[model samples]
Target: MSAWLFDLGNSRLKAAPLGEDGLPGDVLAFAHDGMALAAGWDSVLPPRIDAAHVASVAAPALRVALLDALAARAGRISLASTQPAWAGLRIAYAEPAKLGVDRFLTLLAARRRGGASLLVGVGTALTIDLVDAGGRHHGGRIAPSPTMMREALHARAAQLPAVGGGYRVFAADTGDALASGCLGAALALVGQSREAAVDACGGPVALLLHGGGAEALLPHLADAVHAPALVLEGLACWARPDGARR
Candidate 1:
């Protein structure tokens, strides 16, 4: 039976085909503005699959909307959630459910790579989670992502444009400065988190970067592994009994 995976995030809905190997096929993304769907949301979606597995960090209403859309296409649907431990990986959260499912899934994928890993997801928020060589969650941090930082700045000051410019070492223009500052801040956070992970885990840490905004941070992160479909990749792990050991 064929299965498709859906990752409904705060700003994007990504879907991919789940192969027998438990790896996701080409991923397709759709922009979701909180409650509203952006243009062409339906045009990009794949036709009905045999079953669907959904991992959502969106609001309850958004999940409802997504489920409704999938109901017509999927014979069965399963939702992913945060658990204390799964497939050798243990969550550090005192209240596991409070932790985002996206983060939980990311850890699963990170663990699949084996050994210590630092997952950096840049979406509506910049999230960093550390997993030791033994698959023990060492906690994480969430800050405004680059895009959010720009939006926040623009919101506070009407003069600043939320969307404009590129990253530069020393920005000559306002837009470049905003871009440089936000991305630089993300890069610095990653560096600091890497150091902390080394100190906490007392060993080397693999840098795993993912999410829609990950590209902007890529050029700056030299030792980073880019897995844009990481959340869905983790969803594949959650779908299987053995967690698809590669």
Candidate 2:
């Protein structure tokens, strides 16, 4: 059956076809405002699909817009939500519903790799989740991403440019300094999280990086696996008929 997977993040919408092997096909991404779909979005999806599985962490209005658009093309639609335990991966959140589905799905994908992992999603926010070899979540941390930090700073102090600057160890210019500080903070958090994960898991954990901003940090991470389509990969698993049970 022909199916599609959608991962609606805070600032972007990523969709891919689900192959027969239950993995995502080539992905298509579009950035959207919090309130509305981007122009020409309707023209991009396939003419029809048997199923549409969505994991959305975007604004409610954008989610509704996406669903409404998909309704015309999808025969069936499944929305992914956080669960306390699914497919052997147990959540650390006391209230599973409070956990973002993106993070949950990321953990699900990480667990499937069959080892301890530290998953970092660098998007509008920086999210770090750790799962052991046994598919047990040890919890996670969230913070503003480097891009968000820059935007926030620019908003408060107009002199700081929100977009242009290269990261440096010790920048002489204000823009580079801003970039260094923000990116450094995120890198430091990831480093600390990795150290904590190693202690908790009693060994080194595989570092899996994803999300729009992951590329920025990939060069700095030596052993990180960059899986930009991880959430979609998890959505493919979630869409499987016998995949995960509550």
TM-score for each model: 0.92, 0.97
Query: Could you give candidate 2's per-residue lDDT for residues 13-43 as a string of tens digits?
Result: 9989899877899999988877787899769
Q: Per-residue alpha-carbon lDDT of model 1 for 1-246, expressed as tens digits?
A: 889899998888898889888789998888888996566565655676678999998899989988988887788999999989988899999999999999999999888879999999998899999999898999999999999999999999989999899989899999999999988999999999999999999878999999888988888887889989889989999988553432
Worst 10 residues of 1 by lDDT: 37-46
- The prediction achieving the highest TM-score against the true structure is 2
Q: How accurate is candidate 1 locally (lDDT)?
A: 0.89
Candidate 2 displacement at residue 19 in angstroms: 0.8
lDDT of each: 0.89, 0.91
In model 2, what are the clashing residue pairs, if there are any? none
RMSD of 1: 2.4
- Counted clashes in each candidate structure: 0, 0
